[model samples]
Target: MNERTEYWWVHHDSRIQPAEVGFVGGIPVHFRFLGTAGQVRAESAELIERLPAPPTPVFRPPPAAAASPAVKPQISGSWLWFIGILLLIFVAQCSGPIFDALK
Candidate 1:
């Protein structure tokens, strides 16, 4: 008779944070939920093993001056306005809580 080893990571696929994996006979295996309430199984050997290198630094042009605009400010009223408003709202919210606590 021959006996094989098997392992499983309980609840590997849940809404909870930080998925986990287990090993069986030195071979790790885990469950993954791809869709709604559906579970898919996998093994460490089956999974691709690669160490991703750090991201390369993004090259950005120097700040633009009124005279020589290195990076032209987006002239559209889309992202700039949206992000600007978001920043203002965040600052206002933060200050509101602090002011209320102080008062």
Candidate 2:
């Protein structure tokens, strides 16, 4: 069995460990935590803002085994056509066109 661990997907295809994801009021916890801030570094805010993604698809769970059914239900076309023809014939016989068809 695979054990659940704490991780966060960053950028687009890259993931980082020892990270957590949550929402505060509405904003993401990561942004609230690791968001751009004033420090000694220059252009830090621009780099964060210029990122291609909000890391939006970041915290989503990893792809796992499909829980849905693969094959869809199938019905016999021959049987359905036969039943439909029979019904049409029976209905038409009630009128004068196929008066002798049933008898």
Candidate 3:
């Protein structure tokens, strides 16, 4: 007699050890659990029978397409402005010392 081993499929392509209580698709698709070194597993027939009927796929409205190309924020301009301000502050702070040394 084959022992009924508990198994789990975390997702369509992910798996977890020690089995978890979850289901992926309406139909339990058999997949190999990577945690078990590619050991094949499937949802228990009892669990499949216990699961609520899969919801019928509904027609979802297509996502609205962008009217125009996306405009990326101009981050470089802000960086340049910050550097310019820092340079000005440094020059202002050193002007007195520089003048005194020149004199």
Q: Write one digit per residue (lDDT tens) for candidate 1, span 17-100.
A: 222233456554444432235334544224333223422337877676767848866679787899999999998879978888
Clash pairs (backbone) in predicted model 1: none
User: All candidates' TM-scores?
Assistant: 0.20, 0.25, 0.33
The segments of candidate 1 whose C-alpha lies over 4 angstroms from its true place after superposition are 1-76, 96-103
Alpha-carbon lDDT of model 2: 0.42
Residue-wise C-alpha lDDT for candidate 3, range 4-53, written one tens digit per residue: 32344244334233322333544443444333444334543223223234
Error of 3 at 41 (Å): 71
The collision pairs in model 2 are none
Off by over 4 Å in 2: 1-65, 76-78, 97-103
In model 3, the worst 10-residue window by lDDT is 45-54
- Pairwise TM-score winner, candidates 1 and 3: 3
Pairs with steric clashes in candidate 3: none
Off by over 4 Å in 3: 1-66
